[model samples]
Target: MAETDAAPSIALPPRQTDGWQMLAAIERVLEAERDQLALWVPVGFGAGIAGWFALPGPTGWIGLGIAAAGVGLAALLFGGTSRLGRAVTIFALAMLLGLVAIWTKADWVAAPRIDRPKVVALTGIVEAAEPRPATATIRLLIAPDTGNGLPPRVRINVDAEDLPAPPPAGSRVAVRARLLPPAPPMVPGGYDFARVAWFERIGATGRALDPPVIVAPDGGSSLADIRTRLTAHIEASIKDAGEGGIAASFVTGDQGGIPEDDNEALRRAGLAHLLSVSGLHVTAVVGAVMLLTIRLLALSRRLALHAPLPLIAAGAGALAGIGYTLLTGSEVPTVRSCIAALLVLGGIALGREAITLRLVAAGALIVLVFWPEALAGPSFQLSFAAIAALVAFHEHPKVAAFAARRDEGIVLGGARILLMLLASGVVIEAALSPIALFHFHKAGLYGAAANIVAIPLTTFVVMPAEAIALALDLVGLGAPIWWLVGKALGLLLWIAHVVADAPGSVANLPSMPRGAFALMATGGLWIVLWRTRLRRWGVVPLAMGAIWSLLTPPPDILVTGDGRHVAVRDGRDGIAILRDRAGDYVRDVLGEASGVEGEAPALELMPFARCSADLCAVDVSGGGRTIRLLATRSRDFVDIRAMTRACAAADIVVSDRRLPRTCHPRWLKADAPFLRSTGGLAIRIGSGEVESVAEQVGLHPWGSFAAGSR
Candidate 1:
């Protein structure tokens, strides 16, 4: 070899057409992403879980068969030397694992559900209790006694007046409550409480007929009691309900005490994350502990010289994170943050980079393996997406290089930090907006700006003050710290209010099409996961998704699953409902679905509608088409002859009762039975033609009321 070192004898392949060139390019791209292979596992796994949820009904054996096939395929590919083969095998296995995991979890958590409304006397342990100011009710998680003919768990709310305070968890209690199956979505493409209840093993929900009588008082100091007591202590210390509620939520994750107005304000201001103990809160706790431990240890020179400071600090941080997670009730967000925090600590102990995209992937994978159903929830999606965006933004070559530069002075350094925070906020907002819109149909326009002030205030001032105050309260000397916490929270609340009150601060839109959301999500992931130049192509889909979303037409008419409330879109970008005096819950849901930020006006009040005690006729101008609609104002019967004539002239007819056969609408007949089967209805009309009819409920466990019927 030394005799000539034949200039790396290279064999040139023969030139080929565009097809071969494209294949070669793809292979090159795959090679470039070799280091990123692990990052794709959670994606594939989540896709499988999503597929399982998208199925119309349960298919346990099919999932198992698919997983088995994957195992076999992986085995076959194990012998292959090709990188592509290895990648495919790994992805296939991950997908199958996800499918099997969710299926198994679903089967395991399956429990009997209330088939219909019933009032029964039951005694059970109080697993949890929460206050509901809006409803003037106090909710309790009841763990039924054995052989009660009830599911393992049921939740019922008693009148706030009936009890002095919420019963402590673990207290055995008896109550006569009217139990009903979990409520399905009130509007098309709305939140599904039934599905959530099914997974949590909550068979029924209702209001108590009488107050719960405590059979056995809870005297033991358990974790649940600790949380309850801490919440009570915080609420007692702070006289202001709003501040105290926010403070309690920060420490104990008991958000029940927060007033509805304050909660709405926080959500609109985009500062709502502070109320939830997630990555920010967890990191604050861990970092504070680590800093204190390092400082305290450094004071001891002899011990400091002999001890591994980073490893010791990491261990302390890990412990603090775990304790905080448990204290906060181990919510999905908290659990994910704790998992990520532990991963970071492990990395530190191993002398590796502590934060990276791979860290997010590992945490998500761990959660999916254990609770696969979480993959379908907004909490999981938002949590992981936000973290991944931050990591990816900082990992960019230019950004990382700039961030690594040494600052000449404190002012410059502080400025640099502020700039980075602002930039990170923007990136996070961009990544999370699509998800928020998909789930909630609303996105905060100024969340990034609001976060710049709120996040630092919370992480630095509020959390530390609260933690110290909590510690001092144990010794009855946290008055000053509590004051500081209140002041800091007040500032945060002020910032939120300012941002939320700004005109156009929030973009409320109709529910986005599933296709558009999926496209955006995929594009966002591509941009976050890949480091290659090819990632720029993700913008194409992002743009396409935005266009698709913008093109989606809002429904001209909305009918609740119960047919008790109805809304029709006016020619202007507003909606008018059947009942002008609809309850807050109904009005709010209807408004959001119709892209109206606040209360929608009554159809009778609109110029295009006429209403009476029992009937309402509407003329909706949708896309230059005047859609005639008739709906009942109440369940009271109308003259059959009159109803038939009105319905025959209308494009859509909706009522709470069955309609006569003589009454036929040209477009749709959304009566009680139809609404019951569909859950909710959203109808769009264009140019005198029925454009689309979207139903809220699908063949899912939560919405399938007929299943397990009594």
Candidate 2:
């Protein structure tokens, strides 16, 4: 009887193959995630924006044609009534919508950018002014008298000594300045400041050659004036530059006055987000307003009974959030937070689950729809990622149940809340690490631990104290409160310095490849968005991406497009530069990109390097091979025979002056002409590979704007 039963089971389908089993498993996951489809629409839309940005050249009508064809195909396929067909149709429409939206935005904001440095006399009204210790930056609304060739707006930096006092906004000023286009990426796959400047309508940036003379001073009130006044009041009140600067930042979102050392400490400690007005600050402001309004209303029992107190409070909160966003300069992070807060308020008013992933998705969609360029920026990425991670984690069935459980005592409940906060910090850090590394080449390893102490302090103690003090200042009764605010900020700064000084506080990583970053992002989204156990499969791609990043090696040689600055790997832990006079910005960029942590190694001091008046020779070893590099140090003339011989003997040659045709190196020649075309070069000697900033940038409109030579 057993044999007969086994024979019948075997004949009943011969058991499914591994492939079939896998398909069935995927089907089950799809079934489990049927309700989660809306979350993916934004994902597809973002992918479309990314794809449009990745094109090597302008597609013009070609992209539109392809999108049209895709939609038509989707329509035909969707007629079959299969789930796969329906999903495809939805994805196509979503992506096409994204493409159209971004295209329209880019075209709308396409303003002419300066392509070369020009010393021009600028006379315009000061749109905004940001004062610092050594310099003041003023964004100008260029007057029509400047000629049609100039941008509508320009930003110029003036030495503090040049200005007795920074010109106030709406004051007309005239000055001679050496203006140039906004800078491009310093290296391949680095940050693109030009794209950002383009969107902001800043066509040129420069330093003042002559002190700006005030042509007309207007007595008027504006948001910029209010912000400046507030900053000055806070700074004057606190007295301590660092603490006051931090306080001002918390209040007005102006961080220009913060000391460099303190700013670096905060960044290293992973608390720099405090200086940026984001969700944490916005929520505090809105919550305080709501609480105040509710209490005030509830005091009147007759009105409270008929008022719908919660809805009224929500409206007040929304208004406060909007006002704060505008006051804080409407930066990307603040804008995102305000939008999210408003959506949450709407959800609350409607009596729905207010803090769900759907709320986050809606907020993201709104931002992307209006500001598609923000999709590529760190502000948008980090803000959305942090909130999405928090929502997804707490929304877990187990986590929700645990959080819902009533504690037996106050201490137990407090302990539970702290434990959850710690866990949440860990998850947020993990989710954001890949993105941070991609943009900054490093991630704060101890940020989660530091945030545990810093977040509460900033949210409850520091912000409230500052707000109260600022309010009391108008009545001349804020000294005590300002003192308290300073004390709180002092403690917060101490925490930042302590955490930053901790060993292994920051993970200094090599530049991650774009593909690896994409893969990790996809895996992270998969894990965070799905509810089924099958989401564990995302770990495969996550692991693969991390391994790829760790395995990828830093370049052996880095040369600026002007060929005036060159850097080479010194040892396992250091970098060597060609000239001792290299600027701090250049040194920092090269060191960071080469995976060197901490203070940059002194330039032109490597044991394996030798320099003369006109030339530098460096020997770098990696992957069991040594590369000989020759670079020019100055414009001093050299004998052609000697130069040709030296160049021919080397593996790579770099020079600001064009090299002779006879001076062909074994590997690469990055002379003036080649460098002009390439922008910047990163070479891997062992792999015989080269990457250029220009090649990576492709033919984007922003790439044509010349910051300087490159």
- Estimated TM-score for each candidate: 0.93, 0.93
**Global CA lDDT computed for model 1:** 0.82
Candidate 1 on 1-710: residue-level lDDT in tens? 35865587588877899976776677788899888888999998887787777655555447554765666486566624656666777777777777778878888999999878999998899998877554677889999998789989999988999976777778888999999888777776677788789899999998889877985574676787788778888978887778888989988988887888888878887777778789999999999999999989989998799999878988999999999999889989999999999999999999899999999999999988888878778888889999999999999999998788794799998889889988988898899888888888888888888999898888889888888888898898999898888887778777878888899989888878877887898899889889999789898898889889989888888888778788887767888889877898888888887777766877888887888889888887777677788898776778899988999999889888888989999888878767655667777777333322222233445556332211
Query: How close to the true structure is residue 509 of candidate 1, measured as C-alpha lDDT?
Result: 85
Worst 10 residues of 1 by lDDT: 689-698
Per-residue alpha-carbon lDDT of candidate 2 for residues 133-242, written as tens digits (9 for 90 to 100): 41244334444245536887788888777875556677887789899888877766567788888787888888889878885465667897788778878888888899
User: After superposition, which runs of candidate 1 have C-alpha atoms over 4 Å from their true positions?
Assistant: 1-18, 58-80, 133-135, 687-697, 705-710
**Which lDDT values do the candidates have, in the order given?**
0.82, 0.81
